[model samples]
Target chain A: EAGVVQSPRYKIIEKKQPVAFWCNPISGHNTLYWYRQNLGQGPELLIRYENEEAVDDSQLPKDRFSAERLKGVDSTLKIQPAELGDSAVYLCASKGNTEAFFGQGTRLTVV
Target chain B: DQQVKQNSPSLSVQEGRISILNCDYTNSMFDYFLWYKKYPAEGPTFLISISSIKDKNEDGRFTVFLNKSAKHLSLHIVPSQPGDSAVYFCAAGKSSGDKLTFGTGTRLAVRP
Candidate 1:
């Protein structure tokens, strides 16, 4: 089976511009997650979805960052007025019963 | 606070030798642990996993050991190969929670 898929392997935008990343989970997977990884750091959870409901998103920055998984298959994470600190890798992953699979991720750069 | 930590930032070992990576976590509530391997410009792939109920789990040449009393977990690669050169991340998750907390990761280099 195919692994999780993410769009736009790389992205660059102005510091105050808006940016979005998309992800398609594996077939029949009910769990999806969005994480951000900084240089020399591990991936941190930003949001998690069980089906179409967001079960855990306490780590997400509510002010400018938002995410949705309306169909329970694909997901999108958005950052409005992106900040310089937002430059990092955004990874999406999906899990079925045991292990979770991840996508190549989108490297976002804010200048 | 950082709940999970990989103290060693990098490790180097000769091919056919054993490579051991350590991880320490503070959350006693975490019941499941996993190890992931990542190459450059790619996402992480699952390597091995261990549940809190078991002290060790083995798969092929990779083994994961968990010590609940010490709150420590380890990944061991026996007869390490050059293809094993990659960044390894240790992650922990609770059975009740949906999120998984990960350690900073250790970069391992297996010399041929």
Candidate 2:
């Protein structure tokens, strides 16, 4: 089966602009997650979804970051008025009864 | 506070030798643990996992050992190969919550 898929493997945006990343999880997976990884650091959870419901998004920056999984099969993470600090790799993953599978991720750079 | 930590930022080992990576966690509630391998410019891939009930789990040449008393976990790669060179991250979670807390990660370089 195909692994999780993410679009726009790389993106560059100006500060104060808006940027969005998309993800398509593996088939039949019931859980999806969004994470951010900075240089020399591990990936950090930003949001999680069980089906269409966002179960945990406490770490998400509500002021500028938002995410949604309408049908639960795919998801999108958006950042408005993006700042240079927002530059990082945005990863999306899906999980079933076993381990979670991650996508190639979208590398976003804010200039 | 960071619950999971990988103290070593990087490690180097010869291809025919063994490579050991260590991780420590402060959360006793975490019942499931996993190791992930990541290459530059790509997402992390699941390597191995161990449950709280078992002290050890082995798959092929990779083995994961968990010590509940010490709240420590280690991943061992026997006869390490150059292909094994990558950043390894340790993650912990509870079976009920389905949320994983990840460590800072350790970069391993296997010399050929």
Candidate 3:
């Protein structure tokens, strides 16, 4: 089976510009997560979805970051007016029973 | 505050030797611990995992040891190879499906 899939392996945008990242979870997986990894740090959870509902998103920056999981299979994370600090790798993952598989991730560079 | 921490930023080991990466977590409620291996420009891949109820879990060359009393966990790779060189992250969660808190990661360089 295919693992989690993410679009645009890399993205570059100027500060104050909008950018979006996409993720398609593994088939039959009901849990999806979005995480951001900054340089020299581990991945931090941005949001999580159980099916089509966002069950946890407390770490998400509500002012500029937004995420949606439609049909409980695919998800999209958007950042409006991204700042230079927003440059990082965006990872998507899906869990089935125990283990969560991750995607290749989208590396965003905010200039 | 950082819930999980890998104090060692990097480690170097000779091929055919053992590599031990340590991690400590501050959350006592975390019941599951996992280790992930990551390469450059790639997402982390699950390496091994151990439940809070178990103290040790071994799989081939990788073994994970959890010490609930100390809130510490360590991953050991035996007979390390060049292919094993990568960043390793330690993560903990309350349950198998709960959100995991990760450590900063330890970069292991297995020199051949």
Q: Which candidate has the top score in DockQ? A: 3
Q: Taking the tens digit of each residue's C-alpha lDDT, what string does model 3 give over B1-112?
A: 9999999999999999999999999989999999999999889999999998999999999999998999999999998999999999999999878999999999999999
Off by over 4 Å in 3: none
Largest TM-score belongs to which candidate?
3
Over A73-92, each residue of candidate 2 has an lDDT whose tens digit, in order, gives 88999999899999999999
User: What CAPRI grade goes to candidate 3?
Assistant: high
Which residue runs does candidate 1 get wrong by more than 4 Å? Answer: none
Model 2 residue A5 lDDT score = 96
Candidate 1 has a TM-score of 0.98
Which residue pairs in candidate 2 collide? none
Which scores better on TM-score, 1 or 3? 3
Clashes of 2: 0
As a whole number from 0 to 100, the lDDT of residue A36 in candidate 1 is 98
Evaluate residue B13 in candidate 2 and report its C-alpha lDDT on the 0 to 100 scale: 99
How do the residues B6-81 of candidate 2 rate in per-residue lDDT, one tens digit apiece?
9999999999999999999999999999999999999999999999999999999999999999999999999899
List CA RMSD, all candidates: 0.9, 0.8, 0.6
